[model samples]
Every structure is written in C-alpha cells, then in structure tokens.
Target: MSTTPQRLMLTRTDGSPISALVVDDEAVLAEMVSMALRYEGWTVTTAGDGASAIAAARECRPDIVILDVMLPDLSGLEVLLRLRKLNPALPVLMLTAKDSVEDRIAGLTAGGDDYVTKPFSIEEVVLRLRALLRRAGITTDDGDSQLVVGDLVLDEDSHEVARDGESVTLTSTEFELLRFLMHNPKRVLSKAQILDRVWDYDFGGRSNIVELYISYLRRKIDDGREPMIHTVRGAGYVLKPAR
Candidate 1:
C-alpha cells in the first residue's frame, strides 16, 4: 500500500507562496535548509555570505530569513542591521554556534525574531519558522492545520495528536517519526528513508532505532483500535486508513 505523499502548502495572506532567504557560509548547510523549506511548499533563495545575502534579500524580499551569526565578510549582526533597514518588520531567525546567555541576548537585541544554536535539528528549524510565520500573520493556504488519516489526527501548529477523538501524548522523537509516516500515508517507507528524514542525518547502521519507534507508535496509534500502521515485510512500513 503505497502512494504519493500530499504536500503541505503554506502561503502569504495574499495567496502567493511564502518565500525564504537562507544565509550561511556553509554551502551544504544552506542547501539542506533550503531543501527543507522547499519541501514545505516555499520558495527558497540561498546566500553564502553577508554581501550576497543582502543583495538576495533586496531582490527576493523574502517573507523571512534564516541568518548565520558568523560570516566571512560581515558579522551576522551587521547583516541584520542592513536587512532591517530594508524591511524593519522582517522576521529573522539567527543561527549561531554561540549558546551562552550573553550571546543569545546579543542576537535578540539585534532584532532577531528567534535564535537557534548550531547542531540543531532540521525539524526544529521548520517548527520555529512556522511559529514565526504565524506570529507575523501568515498562514496556511487552507484553514486546515491538522493532518488526518481516518480517525487519527496530528496538529502541526499545536503539536498535538489525537486518535478517535482521544489525545495521544508522544515524545518529540516519536512525534517526528509519526509525522514522517503520516506525511506519506499508505507509502511503504524503507528503514533508510525513515532514518534520513526523521533523524535528519545518517544513523550509521542503526535501523533498529526505527523499529523501536515504530513499536512505540503502534502502541499509541494502533492499540485498542483497528491497526492503521502496517509493516511491508522486507520493504518497510506503511500507514493507511484503518478499515
């Protein structure tokens, strides 16, 4: 039982697709973030340094920005100042390796709407961007926010899950796993695919971790009800509307 995953699309108040500018000196990191944003149905532009970042921002007028605190040419703070001049109310999220209290304070004081330290998960970045968009009065194209398959429901905005109208509490990791499965309902996802998407990195031969989390989901999502999550023998796993 496999099918194409439905794309979750978010757009501006005017119905135009949301856009983002990601500025990081690390080319790979910028690409990863861009890919994640595009997956959410957003248009993404990337810049590797402060000079190009400012230029791209001027051209694209992105709805939001993901800025790195350190850059080869200009400090992220300097870039932030320049960007603010372009759009005072623009939402900016700072990414820094500095996690000290003072460093965090500095980024906030410089007008960053949110701050994320290095070594962060891609999911965290996505979640933070969603919150920023919401606070800025942007919203999904449709009024709907919940992902539904049968009686199971997962609310992206509130981070809540319910099965047959009953709440199901899940740890962050479990929730990410379930969200991945739910995103591709009825699709047989291999262990490698799950590890890459859910974990956001190579798990290095740790397929058992996927099995463990699947069991955890089964306990919460399938227990005491017609099973919706299914294993596809050697291929992988699939989730479908329970019959």
Candidate 2:
C-alpha cells in the first residue's frame, strides 16, 4: 500500500493533540477513517493488515485504536490480544462486517472497548472515536454537558445514554441525531436541517440518510418504551418527553 499515514499535531478543543491508529485491510476504509480523525485534529496512522497494525501500534502508541475485525494476516481479535499485551488499558474500537453478537462479544472480551459493523457511516466512526477518547480521560467541553428530558439522559462526558434507567446503545450517527433532537426538544427539525446538522453537508446528503438513521434511533432509543421521537408529518421530526 502506497498510503502514507498523515500525522498531525493539531490541537483538539481541549488543547491537546490526539494520536490514533487505524487498522483495516480495506485501504479505502482505512483512509476514510484516517482522514476523518485528522479533520478532528487527531494525528493518525494507518495499517493495511494485522501484522502492520501491530507494528504501528507499537510504534505510535496511539491513545485510541480503530481496528477491522477482518484482516488478511490475522483476525482483528488476534490483533487485539497482541495489542493488549502491549497496553492492556488501550481503548480499541472493533470494526467488522459480521452481524453476529458473538463476534461483538469476542472483540469486547478480548479488550476492545466498542464495536462498529461494516458499511458504517464516517460520521459514526468519528463519534465513536470521540467517545473513546473522552472515556480515555480526554476532556470534551462540547458533549460534556448533559441533556435530560424526563427519564432519558445523555451524559456527554461519560458517553452514556439511559432511558427510564436502562442503557441504550446507539451508533455515532444515531447519537448525534438524538442529541440534536434532545437539544431542541419539541421543535420540529426539517429534513434539510437534520441533514446539515447530524451529517456533513455532503455526507450522505440524501434525505434517506435521515430517514434510515431515524429508524435506527427508533429501534434503540424509543423501542420498548413510550416514543419520544415523533414524525411531524411534512415538517420533520420532534423529540418531546413522553407524557
């Protein structure tokens, strides 16, 4: 691979440069993550296979790692095990194409901090990275403030969301959408507003991205509970405390 990793000492909002290692056999996916992290002002390194991933981890000692579960040389789980030996407390986010919960368990059991299935959005990746960094002691002045409506609480500092005292797992995009809705409460945010805010202006510009992710949020955030997210007909969507 002729892809040279770009390392920048760019300052984060907290005034610190974060270093990240991205590992995946798919060159395009790896580059996609690297570029996004760099845009977030993180210094990034990329490796195409498991062996190269291990080598890069040892060399850079990134604060966080985004690793593909499927790699040509060794499985991402194996990479995680080897990485743990070097730094057991490392926060590794596992990326996989598999839809199996067992696969997610294996990655987490092997010391991975979180999981992202393949065909994921870049917005999701960046959010996951930010959450991992925050949990790893990097402070975020942005999401650190909490948003609460009734029983649902989003604690940005801890990267945790709980509704009626139960935890909800959300993709990065889902979290952002929910955050926007929570911040605005009862206001109906139009599709265009959602597209511009939750995603990059060009990031999945189709209104369908908003619809698709709303479905995702519904399943996780509103399922098995009274719905807080409501479709406002031709206007957009709204989130109000279920009363």
* TM-scores for the candidates: 0.85, 0.59
Model 2, 170: alpha-carbon shift in Å? 15
Report lDDT (CA) for all predictions. Answer: 0.88, 0.80
- lDDT digits (tens) for residues 1-243 of candidate 2: 111112223344468788889998888888888888887778899999999989989999888899998899898899999999999888899999999989989988889999999878786677677777667765454433466776788865556888889998877778888877876877889999888777757455568878888899889888988998899899999887877
Model 2 pairs in collision: none
Off by over 4 Å in 1: 1-8, 140-144, 196-206
Q: Mind giving the per-residue lDDT tens digits that candidate 1 earns over 10-105? A: 788778888999999999999999999998889999999999999999999999999999999999999999999999989999999988898789
lDDT of 1: 0.88
In each prediction, how many residue pairs overlap at the backbone (N, C-alpha, C within less than 3 A)? 0, 0
Cα error, residue 52 of model 2, in Å, equals 0.6
Count clashing pairs, candidate 2. 0
At residue 167, give the lDDT of candidate 2: 92
What CA RMSD would candidate 1 show?
2.8
